[model samples]
Target: MSGNRAAIRYAKAILQEANEANAGDIVFDDMRSVQATIRGSKELRVMLKSPVIKAEDKRQALLSIFGDQSKYTHSLINVLVGNKRIDMLSGVTESYISLYNEAKGIKEAIVTTAVALSSELEVQVLEKVKEITGSTNVTLKNDVDASIIGGFILRVGDLQYNASIANKLGNIKREFSKSL
Candidate 1:
């Protein structure tokens, strides 16, 4: 069907196979490596997506690349290739990552500041987030935006906490316009 749907199906298939083989962690690592390989090599991606390439040839290539590392992963790649779903490789890998994260209860947080945060500040922010979300674990990605002037913005999942000076100023400006 659709690329995303196919990708989700393949991801589930891979996860199920991994679980059955009692190598779920190993398969996850292998999937990460596979995703990196596809992202790093344009030629490899082209080969994987090429309609002219035979399924057997694709399977051989995938086996050569990942067999020693992870036989289960190799088989998963082969199945995708055989089904003419190689183009969904990236999406599949992403879906697998999402699934893995959900299984692990890992939360991703994005924190943006006008200036680079010191280690102490970072720790403080992380601790505050943990307290607020009651999340035992947090993956914090940091970004610096000079346009923000000062303060920070924290985004955890679908929720955003914007304390940036730019946002505050914009809000004040809106209030002034309304009053006028």
Candidate 2:
């Protein structure tokens, strides 16, 4: 919980600072790159969590990877490293994205299905979701999950509509047990 709070705090601070400097959009892109890099690299994740490594070394490594970032992002890195909170950088980036999306009135959604969605189905899902949510700026992301067996689950913010086959099976199983 403390980690989440810290990430939110950092995100809010960065959002405010970047907006004041008229670089909110640029920093948003930078945050996306930062999040993508950290999420895709197992080595970087391991290195960030390793306590034996010096903070300065980690800071240098991050700067090199994200050297194209604006001065605002560089300052953010310095602040995190100085406070020994570099491991929370990814969380901070994600939180900042959420905040940015909110500021822009954009809604983000994740749809998990048994198989990859066809482009047509993806458009249909987005239309249905936007209609249901009454949101004009909805962004839908598709995630394939074979474990769900069939159907799809849609999640928008904290609200989830679970129409997946796995959930239905669990409900049926519960009913059968109750009958027994």
Candidate 3:
């Protein structure tokens, strides 16, 4: 828990520096790519979490992978490596992406349903999300979960609407059990 908090703080600091440098967008893209790379590579993730490796070695390895990234990214890696907090790299990058989105007035909504959303449904969801959040710069992600049975679940930041059939059924069962 504390680690995540520290990661978030680091993320915010870097984001502020990126904005001050007038390279927020470029750094945002770099962080997105870094997040994608870390999430995609099992070996890299393992290596990052391993305490056996020297911080300098890990730093050099990351530098090689993200050679083309912006100066802020390079500095971030430097700070993490110097502080021996390289294990927090992924968490920090993810937090940074979230901060970047919030800074740009972009809200991410995650929709889960029994099946993939049709184009029309997706548009409708986006419209509903905009109405709820009052943010026009909304990004939607659709996740399919058959166990939800039907309907959809919508999440925007810390707010969630669990309108799934499974959830409704559970609520009904709970209400009936309580009446007994």
lDDT for model 3: 0.91
Q: Give the per-residue lDDT of model 2 (tens digit) for 1-180.
A: 113989999999999999999999999999989988898899999988999999999999989988999998999999999999999999999899999998999998889999999999999999998998998799887888899999999999888999999999999999999999
Alpha-carbon deviation at 90 in model 1, angstroms: 1.7
Please tell me which predicted candidate would have the highest lDDT against the true structure: 2
> What are the lDDT figures for the candidates, one per model?
0.81, 0.92, 0.91
Tens-digit per-residue lDDT, 11-94, candidate 3: 999989989889999999998899889987999999999989888899999999999999899999999999989899989988
- Superposition error at 106 for model 1 (Å): 1.6
User: Positional deviation of 164 in candidate 3, in angstroms?
Assistant: 4.5
- Compute each candidate's TM-score over C-alphas: 0.64, 0.87, 0.78
What is the per-residue lDDT of model 1 for residues 82-107, given as tens digits with 9 covering 90 to 100?
77776777788867866666677877
RMSD of 2: 2.4
Error of 1 at 11 (Å): 1.1
Q: Runs in model 3 with CA error above 4 Å?
A: 1-3, 112-124, 142-152, 164-180
Worst 10 residues of 3 by lDDT: 1-10
Q: Which candidate, 2 or 3, has the higher TM-score?
A: 2
